[model samples]
Target chain A: EDQVTQSPEALRLQEGESSSLNCSYTVSGLRGLFWYRQDPGKGPEFLFTLYSAGEEKEKERLKATLTKKESFLHITAPKPEDSATYLCAVQVGGGKLIFGQGTELSVKP
Target chain B: DTAVSQTPKYLVTQMGNDKSIKCEQNLGHDTMYWYKQDSKKFLKIMFSYNNKELIINETVPNRFSPKSPDKAHLNLHINSLELGDSAVYFCASSQQRQKGEKLFFGSGTQLSVL
Candidate 1:
């Protein structure tokens, strides 16, 4: 069975605080790993896609790194506007995506 | 412009009723998908259509059916809705059915089955 797990279901950080969210997966064959940010009452917004181990991508204040069995989303100097639920998904051999339960992040000002 | 759009941003109804959620994409993508987000905030892929053809269907109940009239549109119809069916449904599209393509998503439709 293919499964994705995200650690630290919820996190609270003061403005400018930096931290990393973890996404670990178990699948037969890894095809891709995706990161998304979802605001309250809205769908997820695409962030980054990592295809192989040691791959990393960055956008603004967010950086995503992927490994053989897990991925990490690191937030740097986060602002209150950056508060959102971060989701991680893994694509297996098939084209479908298996998503992990998101991490709710709160950047208090 | 909104890349992907879904109708009925919020729907609340009784169990046993039937309803449908419509989704359309203006991104000129050939592949579209439907995903359900439970209360636990876990998103699960329910169906995938490529060029109006069903490409992937997960373990969703038969009551949940997806219709894609064209590559730009995909709708989800639910029959005999149950309380467990309450969740947010998201519509998304990608340029193609590639393994690592980025998906553009619409604001989800929140369904409440009482």
Candidate 2:
């Protein structure tokens, strides 16, 4: 069965702290991996899309790196406004995108 | 302007009642999708429409039906709503021809069934 799992269901960090979130997948044919940031009472906002292994993408304070079996979203000196649930999804055959339980990050100022 | 938008931002109803959530995307995308997020914040795809055609339907209950009246509109109707059906339903869109393109999501509709 194709599955995506994210580690650290919840993360609490002080402002300007750094951390990393993990997303591991076990799909037969991996077409793409996407990262999204969702805030409370709002929909998810697209962050980055990693297509193959060793691919990395960055925006502002967040950087996403993908590998053969897992992906990592690294936060460098995050701020309170940067706190949100980060979602990871893997695209499978027929354009089916499977999502993992998101990691809720809370940065306290 | 909103790229993707859904109506009835909040829906509260009793069990066994029927309701519908409407969605529209102005991004000119070829594909639209419905995803459900449970209390645990786990998102799961329910249905997908590509160019107004049903393309992907996950293991969802028959009571949950998706209708695409046109290329830019996809609505989800639930019959005999149950308490377990309470969740945030999100509408999303993407270009099917553009492989690996990021999906644009709308502000989710929060459904609460008592």
In model 1, the clashing pairs are: none
What TM-score goes with each of the models? 0.97, 0.98
Best by lDDT: 2
List pairs with backbone clashes in candidate 2. none
Per-residue accuracy of model 1 over B1-114 as CA lDDT, tens digit each: 888999999999999999999999999999999999999999999999999999899899999999998999999999999999999999999898778988898999999999
Name the best candidate (by DockQ): 1
Lowest summed lDDT window (length 10), candidate 2 chain B: B94-103
After superposition, candidate 2 runs with Cα above 4 Å error: none
- Once model 1 is optimally superposed onto the true structure by TM-score, how far is the C-alpha of residue A51 displaced, in angstroms? 1.1
Question: What is model 1's interface RMSD?
Answer: 1.0
